[model samples]
Target: MRFYLQACLLTTLLGLYLCISEDSTNQDEKLPTIGVSVLIRNKAHSLPYFFTYLVNLSYPKDRMYIWIHSDFNEDNSIEIIEAWAEEYKSQYNGMYITTNNSSGPLHSGEQHYVKWIPEHFNHVIKLRQQALDFARKQWADYLFMVDADVFLTNPDTLELLLGKKLTVVAPMLLSDGLYSNFWCGMTENYYYLRTDEYKPIREREKTGCFAVPMVHTAVLINLKRTVTDKLTYTHTNLQSYDGPVDDIIIFALSAKWNGVELYVCNDYVYGYVQVPMEENDGIQSDVEQLVNVKLEAISKGTPLFWDPFFSKFVDYPPPSKYGLDEIYMINLARRTTRRELMEQSFKELAMDVKLVEGVDGRTLDFTNLGALGVTLMPNYEDPYHKRPMKTGEIGCFLSHYYIWQEVVEKGYQRVLVLEDDIHFTPYFRIKILLLLSELEDLDWELVYIGRKIMTDDEEMVSRYTSRPGYTYWTLGYILNQSGAQKLINAKPLEKMLPVDEFLPIMFNEHPNDTWKSYFPNRDLKALSAAPLLVHPTHYTGQEGYVSDTEDSIVLDGSAFVDGRIVIDHATSRIIGRINSEL
Candidate 1:
């Protein structure tokens, strides 16, 4: 009887162990249902790539559901998605595609334009919410929101993200150079806070994941754990140092309020797809498109010649024996503060500089101004109160003229003329020499180191080639004796416009014969180093310098055409275009 009782106990223990083992096996085999929610507003071109990666995810398609929300009928994105859904619905748990009428105009003008600000921000927020709402209703175990522009190059991206078991996480999506989809910190007032850790995070040699204040482009949420907690993509009243906040910031703030931490993973690579140049919406110029392509190539670990004008890389050439006779810096005498800044800039460039005392426009006699044929147009308008060239403007013009006189009188072959507010890039000297070598055969009147091409003239020569065009500003340039002699002989005093404005007239044939006869269009050759070798010191804000040019301006209501300067805070929030690794 004792042996029989022991045998029954052993049988019961074995049965219990088998039951536990079967249950564990079932749990290991069960796959979580994942819903991919994508909103396609204007990304029809990206559909082919997006669908290719989506269909190829390492995660089981039988357990995955894809929901595409599109509003654009023109791109045929809806048709493509519908066909994909029809073909794949049987393979997956569910496939859904929905189209909602877009809320705003079909094509809002250039995104960078000031007109489409908060309106653009609100439109995007609404679309994201629509996607989120649709995904939430499907009872997905996990919901992933991806921009059409993001191409998931990793096959196991979904599986890898699921392993983290985090409430919210995103893969690192980068553009061009150091720009990425995540900001490391936030300021007290909620602006993009730049911390010292930014470089370390961006330049990490090994793969790792790190916490970030905000995440965008591609993100995953554990819907069962996080989304059910009533999180939302809503607009808030948060204000940054610049203007009103957008949905991304609002989402970040909301998540933080709910005690949810956002993380970005850089353990694997993903491609931020770039728009093709031919399909570009005419917002970016051809030159910009070429630069974007070059930058995109560099970001993908490809080696190429680093054009300092357009790239952050600095490849210095050996110091050139070619040297200018003298470097003249035009600065106001009373501005001892500005003079010091110029001195520091010259020292950094290893250049010997002479300071040309600027003529104070305010102190100039206005009674004889008409003799110089200076006339303010009756209909002239200054948007930034930049017109009606102040006494400072006259003084600045005369300073360049004085330098021109010195160049001609001293028989200097070439002189470097720089503004007091000039700032140089690291490879400035090398770039200048390289540019000179390229144009050695051609005689150039002026070579602009830094200038703003205000007009959209497609006929302009390729950058670095001696081109005839309308360019603005004179921050840094090289003028030869012949150019100086032409300026002195032209007697520019006859029609004393701002020096910058007069330059184009001097270079081109003017309609007015009085000016045309004296300043006949000579080979006033000018070229710019693309990406520009110099910028205003104020832009860099080095040496505790403030702009002496615009510091004293007081714009009254009367100055504006509409009696008020319109502020569109949304313009600041627009994300730049993505450059693809391909």
Candidate 2:
């Protein structure tokens, strides 16, 4: 049984010792146990995403205990924790939930004794101390400090951490980007605090922590004798603050103080959400075929970097003009064309209910100038071939770019870009209208017009952009004017990833932009709140995919087109090539 542990080269001495000790241990002894502590507030917003982790944890349920520490007495936070505890207990019988009242935002490190509304810095430090105390009292071997918003993309995250010597803060990598706040949540103070004479690191790629950049919700810490002895926690550098007191800085300072080797887990498994990946295959369409191809390639040790841009949801080089959203849509179309199955899939996607123009053939019910914005499905020259060219999705990009240039000329600040084949929850439109109304005051840049698996309650921050939790699916997001400007003024479409994944990546990746998630793109909200979008599952009584074919389609002698069409009952396409034979 080979297990991989993550660490920086600074711990070479300790690493050798640990290896020798592990080798000497008898196989009869039970494997070291890893305990996880999660601190959550405002359960309504963050719990759903937490639940996804609870149900999908990668380690053995019996070997792990999840301690939920929250400040929820006055507000409904405790009740939400209690409810989730019951569910977790029902599933993972060994899991436990604990509640504590926080002194509300600790403003400074002083005032250690608990008081209601303690300084934000004090509150977090105290909470961490409390969690550590609980773990010590319980006699757990290792403690995993996690946040409610953090989830494991790879279910075997624990397996990866087992037997590791104090795995410092690490972030998970996804097709979208790194899955940790360490990258995206950095403020001016954050960089300054991390370094001695802090000079703002402007590089977008220098996201992951230098010497464990972040102690985000998901960190594996060891309760080893070496660590337990030298650790004397203090709060002197951080002054009056209202929010998270840069725990990563504290960890770094402590590591410097003690001889403890601060291992920076640089693996993708321990990365934060902001550090963008080359591309993610998980969120791509034709998943089965894609997965099979990747798996086969991996088995054969192939580089599997062919058409690297296609794997990205956003093109690498963003469009360099105003209102180039159309080019992005076309880029997505070209990528989807790679999979032969996407052609009919999108046509099937069109069967969902749409607000059609009655007789004018021009306007629809979606035109709400007051509270909500509306998207008018423009008819392209060839319609199906919304673009003009074919092989490898060339003209589609130009066609969409032209469309965006026209729309921008019409004075639309922010518009929803939906790739006609996108499926939605039944109430997607209604909910979007309400979201639009709510976001009238918000400074957002984009609004997704699709369906996705949403997690978390309401108050979610730390999005890849200043906006968090709105990653992966681009089905529905609301962009404000500034964000709109950013998109329209971006670089070439080829410079970035796909649009759905690109906006959040750019927002978070940008050295200056401050974006956060106002709302998560989960299904419950999309359906219950009358969002007004539906998939074939709601209309044609079919799931999203039905066929297992490997061919494209041709419509009216053209291959590239916009608007959804179904090949069978389940699959659909956004913009794809036509099968010459069909």
- How far residue 530's Cα lies from its native spot in candidate 2, in Å, is 29
Q: How does candidate 2 score on lDDT?
A: 0.40
Q: What's the alpha carbon RMSD for model 2?
A: 19.4
Compose the digit string of candidate 1's lDDT tens values, residues 135-232.
Answer: 77877788888877666767799988988888889988654446677789898766688888776666555468888898877888888885445566
Per TM-score, the best of the predicted structures is 1
User: What tens digits encode model 2's per-residue C-alpha lDDT throughout 1-582?
Assistant: 123233444378688888888888845766567677877654333344345555566666666777776663334556666765775675552576666656452234533222323355455677777777777777777777776544354566666655344535444332221123433233545453343311222222333334533444456667756555334233453344333344555654465456555433434333212121122322122222223322222222221232222232211222121222221232232333322232222222221221211111011111221122211112223222343222112222233334445455665555554443333432222344455565545544554444342434324321212234444434334333455445555532422122333444444421212111211221111111123242222222333332111012222223332222223324332232224443
- Model 1 error, position 508 (Å): 32
Off by over 4 Å in 2: 1-28, 72-75, 90-96, 100-118, 163-169, 172-179, 183-210, 236-248, 269-417, 420-582
Off by over 4 Å in 1: 1-14, 72-91, 100-104, 107-120, 226-228, 235-245, 273-582
TM-score, candidate 2, is 0.43
The estimated TM-scores of all candidates read 0.47, 0.43
In model 1, what lDDT does residue 121 have?
67
